[model samples]
Target: MRFSSTVAFPLAANLLPPLASAIRISPAPNGALLLRDSYDYIVVGAGIGGLVVANRLTEDPSVSVLVIEAGDLDDRGEDVSIPGSVGFEDPRRYEVKLTMTEQEFLDNKTRTVSQGKAVGGGTIVNGLVWTRGSTANFDAWERLGNPGWGWSGLLPYFRKSETYSTRDHDISACKIPVPVHPVNGKHGDQGPVEVGYPNYYYNQSDNFLDGVQQLGIPVNEDPNSGNATGATVVPSSMTQKNQSRSDARTAYLDPALGRDNLHLVTNHTVTHILHNSSGNAIASRDTPIVNVTGVEFASNVTGTMMNVTCDKEVILAAGAILSPVLLQISGIGPAQHLKDLGVNVAVDLPGVGSNFQDHPTLQPVYKYTAPDVFSVQDIVGATRDAVREEYLANRTGPWTTPMVNAVAFPALSWVTDNFRELLDEAVNTTSNLPSSYDSTLRAGYAAQKNETLCFLSRTDTPTYELMSTSWGQLAVSAMQPFSRGTVLARSSSIFDNTQPIVDPRYCSNSIDCKLLLLGIKFNDHLIATSPMAALMPVPPPGFGTADARNETSLDETMRAMITTGFHFSGTTSMLPQNLGGVVDPSLRVYGTANLRVVDAGVIPLLPGAHTQATVYAIAEKAADIIKAGSSDAFPGAKS
Candidate 1:
């Protein structure tokens, strides 16, 4: 499997429909008919991670696997299947939006965080961009405490998750040349997920590149080739057969549903992970360590709590936001926080909900004065009706990709001339962690800060990203955010009727804002340059000015426009237990046997890339670990 990198590459010419999903495993309203009393393994949250694990574990046929999901199967046709039908499709049909706790840094404004509400998880609604940030991003995971979790160690599994395609296909239906990435050996050929270039490349790709190259930033050509510091065209996870969205369900789960060994129960939220008790409803304090035995779930339709047993293990693939909340509610989080929430402490892991990180984006939309060029802006604005009709009728055109066709990943040095000063200020500040953080969390933040500082000083690793959409909108995200936050549970019971307090603490570190503002400065210059100047003639508001904006004005813009790239991770980090880590290198919950987290939550650090592709890779690697009996395979395992 290969993930191509791009800052702002075009998507056109290489297109196909979708693989036949005639045999989908519909969501079982109740597990009574589909589930067993005790399966070899129980996977919670039938999202990317759980589905991959279930499909692989059941391959033995000798063992049975059960999957529990909180949402129903995706039934929204185009919204769930189309490649670039993100904002244009039914927005919230398959997603559950959580109102995050008011961000103190963002002027006490609460943002809505939307997660996939269906069985397929976030894959059901995320942007179809598939990429891995850089080699430094994954290598940092190994530096945090995990062995064989680095870039080289994980690339094989990344290759094992997707079938990368580079061959040209018919593009005449839409009357365009097929756009494709180079077929390097770094990609895979026979995998579940489909990885390939879209069928329509935006004409402005070369123009943007020319304008950027004038600034001395070289083209990376491939963002996933261990270097993600330049502009390039990225690949999307779409089926080569029909040019439809290829997600966890369409790629991995749908094809394996006929196997009797695998069972899935959707529309059921796993409230708590049942464990070996000290003969009590809540395990006694004396028995701090326990093994998971089963799970207690509440039905979405009935709201009734039910239990199912598992003979081997319980894997949490609920995602970064929910996984840590699950651990806290399951008596396995920070002991003090659990006690305050009236929950018994099974494992006093302080890191269960700490180290929360995400890519904080600043979305600034710029309207073009004219739509004369060959960019998505030109195609969508000039011939909107005709292009949409062509895409829906023939499955080709600019509609196959989201409006955002190109991206720019520049190191701090390229972003701003004051890099040394920012690094110095960051290094001298000592701590950028949240106030409520525990000592162990501070230790972890310190380690992460050092890694971030290293990334900031480097010229090849991108610390910020700049992307442009078809609508003349520009979005930038701080790639390696220094600030850390927490995901605190509201109560011990899942029936609390409240979402967890997800405080990403965006822009808490002053340095993050500086980086984003610098990114804006870089984009401002590029838009005014020769080739891009003709495409998008107007300068963005509060940008592209001869005079630099003041700190106060920039701060106001950041506070008003800040949002997420939806690339969340690091709540239940994989690191040393003593360093505020929830899961060990083997992805197991510390101090608990037979319980593991196989999702984005365990990623110790947020990767510079979109999370979907990396999540697929992590899930693939985790399946291998679970099947090998983690304890015996990785002796340095913390759990």
Candidate 2:
């Protein structure tokens, strides 16, 4: 089946009535006009986190907020809104040119890393899966010295950010059968973001669910209810009526656009964070720590520079990559590395771009030969007229769904017989630490290893996630990998347009490799088992060529095929300063008084789920934290 690189469907233009009427946006002003313009708050990026903080902080009519986004407003265009479309390929819609450095473990190959350059950020180009990590995942954050960040503490914000809508039509309409639970989940119904299921379900969904159950994995009542183990059909961030993609723009930014206090500056890239300094502007260890004052930005189109000051605070929500890069170039990274780049070191924090983590994923395809079953191939491979008819007649069709409807999170025990031995090796082995790792990074990894080993027996603390799509693909990923990577600025110039050196160091740790191998072996077993085998499954056209019957054969395929999950985080981790943490528990930088990083960058560790939902919850909680003046105002806030 061949998919078009560009589909001509402007789904965002058809946002349901009330949501469209709420926005009041305008283009950014000229860079020359703002020499010393100031506001109550300055948000660096207009992604999900930045937008959420901007909207909430502007709630008080007196406080003025400015959001400077590198990309323009994507008005639900064809690439941004349509599912399974090549939105990530559109340079205007996403940062398609971003490439990571050659990973040493993945056969020294450079991986293409796609980040949303548009206003909505990654939410504009992702698969639209709305899922939260396991309870153990969040609890690990609090255990790592971040107070009030466990599952229970963040649940309210999760509920507050979403407006749940049940699927109105019957599942039988899509020729798929599964037990329905309309109210078993704990989701909000009054928030701005829409959460619901697609009108169409692939016929393979039931087979995938049954295959996992046959493996002794229990069915989860609700994947979002703190426990994400078992086979489940996860909901997505989309509207129920036409299944329009509900991104940060529709949920958080649009609703707050009418506020007179909020100002959005599109097509502006934040170059560096400005701090109070003197004498040749050379920052060193002896330099006294001062509060962040403002930021300098460059016009995306014309390259003109401008400075915008803030009276209260400067929030960095430029996501995992840019957020850390901003700090590094702004003289807030490792002292030695900064000096090499000719950047003044404002704070000699070694953890600015360290502790980088991401999910290493691979596709294990299985060709199911069932005449009665309908696959995504039948949709995308169909005549253009047929797809167009279904879409134009009713917005809910194969063209609207991203084909990733069902997902499974399986524990190590469910996959391998020697779970105990694997856990011991994973927890005890510290030699896997890369040569670049310093004493501080090693200590941080030690803490993470201990916490992960503590949850070895818990089924909910899954080490890997298996997401099934209608395209005969099993997307397997090691969720809570111990392997750490680093993202550093190659040059001092932020606009040198030089891609940062992103080395995920996939499979660097033996335990991570072992766990990923287990996940691949589990998929092989599931496909060869009863319910799935009934469909006469065969190896996907080109993949699984070598026999996947054993770990040895599968390990080779895993190494050659493993790719980035696009869930980059942990660069600017939120932990204690002594534990190699850049940001404190309050989401504040340790040295700066009024600077905070409220994006995926602050996630101390990678969770066992997709990053979209957790990013929203983090923003919601950040709003309340910023409003109350301190993290201690919250119930779970640590001293």
Candidate 3:
């Protein structure tokens, strides 16, 4: 049922257009051609979601699919492809170089929020850990008016998106209690995306796991299964040979290069969606849900404006920040905001850019002063050169293994004492949110708070995610944060180079601050355990651990230390319109006929796991939904 094979594309495309014009080609068959043309579907943003949807929809040779990517191919060289290049930061790879408005809680400091600008999106420059959330996470989607979006409904598509592989040798030989499923047939084997465990495991990785076991957390062999609790060795989207990154470019796009039915236009920024007149027909109470005719775009290099039409639909997969920005500029946002910005209202959909959620993380670096292990700094001069030579020769060395190899998911009760009472107090108070929110948004936040309490009560699901990365750092993140922020266009024009204002509202919610502190306490306990204590861990050699004896000190230290987990969602939520949602169960924008959002933005809630795994599954399911509704989609498609 998977369309991962490139062979299927040509066989199917033979029934319609010639091979040359099947996908994307410059210097048209004729002398000249206008960039503004029509296609059955025009997908904006070439992220994983957009790529997956385009690949599946293009299975129909009769139906043309065009993917317009704002960023160029990630030709960033070795820094992007190699594993050890993680700690290095490169600003050119990101599309949205945003800084949040000074936070009221985080010492009034503005934190930078970046998004991937490459053709493969964040996959090109993200930590490639692969894991899924608990069953309760997806079931919550069903509870929020999105029927058939629970774990059971989505697992099939999860398996459909990637080819899962395990290590050849017994991973148990490491003597670490970490359970690993070597070759489970339940996982995908023939999909384009490669999902596998690392071939090389660090010496300290086993020690880290042992430390977690000493802390009384169970060891899970596989977190990909529904109930994701306990410590486990995480799988990643990596190649089996070189153990290098396997991103959206390698997954869905490269295979279908010869597909003339699929067109990829790179280095073009999508400015705004073009809509047709609704005439006298009212879409709702006082708004018009006008049909999206096309999208206006401009070349990144030349800055030449262009227009492209769609016969069927315009899909927006422009991530959380940009997607909402696009909607706002196109007049499908808050009526008052649009009016203030001098844009004609398409729909007074109040929920276009509200409910922004992310995994706010705090990384506490510990100095590894133990013997028999080498940190990134230990391999200096000659040793570093030798290691680099070995890696370049075979692509299998210390550099081949990513710093993030293992993770632990701990329940709140396991991490903190009297967690229930602490949670109840947090839930009862309205200080978790700003008091001036609109009535609909406030109701949405209230519903989210209830759902979060329900999540906290589940022992099988963990509220906090803990990980040890780069040999000397402990990453403690509040996986299910109660804080909801906003993404707003800096100006009325979509052409404005100024990035959208992204406010994650990190630690703004009292519950979120409490959870983060609990996570920090949990990490401290882990390092202080017998096995880890013998390692003689210090605070990055110079800096000392926060003296969080009191609430004020803890709050102040956390404000200075907090950063993003890079998992942003819920800007364009999937709840019903009445609940301040932008998209419906089918991912279609509430009031638009031919516009749908198929990115992390539509995720109404943040799952306990990383956003990578769930996003691929969501995209796969979205493709199925679009295919079932299309007359010319593949055969034997589910409706």
RMSD vs true structure, all candidates: 5.3, 3.6, 6.4
After superposition, candidate 3 runs with Cα above 4 Å error: 1-36, 93-96, 170-177, 182-186, 278-288, 300-302, 431-436, 540-546, 630-639
Tens-digit lDDT string for candidate 3 (1-639): 000111100011211212223355453565233353799999999999999999888878888888988777665355566665554435555445677878876778887766778878988877788878888998988887787788878877788887887776653233333768633534777777888766556676777888999888888887888878888888888877666678887688877778778888876788889997443222342242588999988765356567889998999999988899898888888777777778777777777778989988877778778776676555457886776666667665566666687789998887767987987877775545544356777777777778888889887788888887645688888888888788878777776735677788887777788788777767677778877776778863213445645656766777677877889899889887767888877788866777889999999888998887888888888887887773123222232
Ranking by TM-score: 2, 3, 1
Backbone clash pairs for candidate 3 read: 22-259, 22-260, 22-261, 23-259, 23-260, 179-221
Q: What is the lDDT of residue 86 in candidate 1?
A: 58
lDDT digits (tens) for residues 502-571 of candidate 2: 7888887767777887787787778876878877777753345356655565676678778888799999
Can you tell me which runs of candidate 2 are displaced by over 4 Å?
1-36, 84-92, 169-172, 175-177, 180-185, 278-288, 380-383, 540-546, 549-553, 635-639
Residue 628 displacement (Å), model 3? 1.3
* lDDT scores in order: 0.74, 0.76, 0.75
The lDDT, on a scale of 0 to 1, for candidate 1 is: 0.74
Task: Give the CA lDDT, 0 to 100, for residue 510 in model 2.
Answer: 67
